[model samples]
Target: MDPMYQELKEIEHRPYPLQPSPWLMTQVWRDLLFMHYPVSTDIIKSYIPTELELDIFENKAWISMIPLRITNMRARGIPPVPYMNSYLELNVRTYVVYQGIPGIYFFSLDANHPLVVTGARTVTGLPYKHANMSFEKHEETFHYASQRIHTAKKLNVAYQPGHILFEPQEGSIDHWLLERYCMYSFRGGQILRGDIHHDKWKVNRAEAVISTNTLVPFIPGEFIGKPPLLHYSRRRRFFIYPLKEV
Candidate 1:
C-alpha cells in the first residue's frame, strides 16, 4: 500500500466544500464586466480600481475567487506556442468549492489582493489557464474562446441584480486592477499541489472508485482504490446555459 494511502485511510472523514448562493451569482457577473473590463471614462468608477494605484507593472499580487463550474478539459499542453507546456501554472493560490448544486466555483488568490474572483463555468470548471481573463488566451480571437464566453454568457443568465451598480471607484484606486476585477494571475512561484490540506472527503471510497475509473483518472489518496461491486447513486448535475440568456 502507498504511504499516502495509509495516511488517508487513517482519516475517517473530510469537510465539504463551500457552495455559492444566489446573491453571489448576482455579484460575480456584475464585477467581471463592469469591474474587470478596462474601459475609459467608466461610470462604475466606484467599483473599479484605479490604474495609478494598481502596480500592474510592479507585479503586485492578489487572489481572485471565480464562482463557477468546469465545462471543458484538456491535457496540459502548449498551443501554437510550442516548446512550452501550457497549464494553469500561474503562481497563485486557487481553491475550487463544490456549489452543492452543479458546478464548482474557483477562488484564485495572489499577492495583489485577498480574494478577487475572475470567472466561472456552468457545465464544468474552466480548463487549466482557460479561465484566466488576464491571459492572452482570453484575448485570443479565433480559438475556442467559447469556454470563457460561454461562462460569461452563463453568468449573464444567472445575473439577477435588481439594483446592482457597475462602476469604478471615485478616487484613484489604491489596489491592483486585477484585484478589483479579480482577473489577473500571480507573478511568482505557485503553491504546492499535495499541500491542499483538505480534511473532508467529497465522496466515499466506493463512489470515488467509480468516479476515477469511469470518468476521470483517479487521484490516489489514502484508502479507496479498487472498484466497488455496485454503482453509487448521484444527484442530477445542474447547468446554467449561457446561450439561453436574454
Candidate 2:
C-alpha cells in the first residue's frame, strides 16, 4: 500500500479532536499559500469534535460577520410624533469555520424569526395554528433581503468580496479582522507566536466553503444550542450569500 494512501486512511478512521503536532500549523499554512494540498494536518489545529472549553482553544482562529437579512416593516401607529412608521432591524450574526484555505462554511438560520412573511397557515381550515418561523440558506433567502430592504434607507454597509489579504504581526491579527472573517476574535489573532512557535508563516488560502450547495446560503432560523452554555451559544451561523459580481 502507498504511504500517502495509508496515512489518509488512518486519519479518516480517527476521532474528531485529532491532536495534531504543533508543527501542523506551519505545514498547513505553507500548503495553503502555495496551493499544495492533500496534506493531512492533525498535528497543528485538529478538527474540533465536541464542545471545548474556551481556554483550550484560546488564540485559535475564529470568524464573525453581520448576516444579511431584512426586518419586517411595522405599521404606522397613531403617535405624539405623528406620521412616523417604525421598522425593526433585521440583522444576524454569522460564523466561519476556517479550513486550511477554503474552509467549510455553515450558516445558522433561526427558524423562529423569518425575514419573509408568508401568510399565517391554518391546519384545520380554521384560524392560524402554531406559528412556524424557519430560516434557510437557500438562494431565495439571498433575494429576500434585497426585496425587503429595497425601501429601507441604507444605513451602514461594509463587506468586500474577492481575494483579500491579512498580515498579522507575528501572526497576530486585529480583533476586527477576525470578526469580519466571521470567526470569534479573541486576543486579536488565532495563530500567534505562542500558537506557531515560529518567526513567520504565510497563509496562501483562506476561504469559507459550503459542504453542499443543496441548501440556501444562510437561513436565520435553526437550532443553535441549549442556553446557559456560554461558549456553545456564542458561535454565529454562516451562509454563503451570493458573491457580488466584480
Candidate 3:
C-alpha cells in the first residue's frame, strides 16, 4: 500500500475502533482557534453528566474554547442550504469517555444562525444557543467576537497563525486534545453518541490576545486567569454522523 494511504488508514482505525456507518451531514470548519485551559477535575465533573467519565491528561482536566467559521454545511447527498449554510460558532467543551470510547462533551455551543441552532438542538440533542457573531481578517490577524443572546457570556479575541504548519506528535498533550473522533451528548435522561470523521489536523503555532472572555461561567474564577494553550488551523472538512443512543 502507498505510505500516505497507510497513514490515513491508521488514523481512521486507531484510538476509537469504530466509524459511523452512514454519515448524516458534511461541513467545513475554517480558521479555527483552539484555546485550552487546565481546570480542576472536581469543577469539571460537577458540570458534566454523571454518566460520563472525565478524561484527564497528566492528572489534570482541560476545557477548550474554540472559535471557528463554518461553511459548506449540507445534508447527505444535497448541496449547501441557502441562508442557513454558513456562520460563526464558538463552543466550550471538555473530554469524556463512556465504555472506553473517548469523545467530546460540550458545555455550550453558540452559533449566529437560529435555524442552524434549532436544527442542531433538534437533531443532536446538544446544548445549542443563539448568538451574535462576527469575523474579519486584517492584514495578518483574524478578529473574532461572539455574544450570547440570553446570557452575559461573550468572547472577543484577535489571533493569527505563526509561520509553520505542523502536526502534533503522538503521545503529546496536543495530540490528546486535538485527535478525538467521537462526542457524547445528554438528552432526556439518556446519553447519545456521535462520531465525526476528518483528516488529521494540520496545526499551526498560534498567537492570541483575548480582550474579553466570559464563555464558561461555571469554571472557577481563579482558573480563568491563567493563559490558555493556543493553536490554529486554517481549514478541515468534516463528516458528521447522526447521534446514536448509547
Model 1 agreement with the true structure over 108-184: per-residue lDDT tens digits: 21111112223322222222333332212122111111123223321111111123322222232312221121222
Candidate that would win on TM-score: 3
RMSD (CA, Å), each prediction: 22.8, 21.3, 3.5
TM-score of 1: 0.17
Name model 3 segments beyond 4 Å from true: 1-13, 18-20, 218-226
For candidate 3, lDDT tens digit of each residue in 145-226?
9999988999999998999999898889899999989899999999999988787887997888888888876555654544
Predicted structure 2: clash tally: 33
> Lowest summed-lDDT stretch of 10 residues in model 3?
1-10
Local distance difference test, each candidate: 0.20, 0.21, 0.86
Positional deviation of residue 75's Cα in model 3 after best superposition, in angstroms: 0.6
Candidate 2 vs candidate 3: which has greater TM-score? 3
38-121 in candidate 2: lDDT tens per residue? 111232133321221211123433322222332222222212222222111222222223332112122222122232222211
Best by lDDT: 3
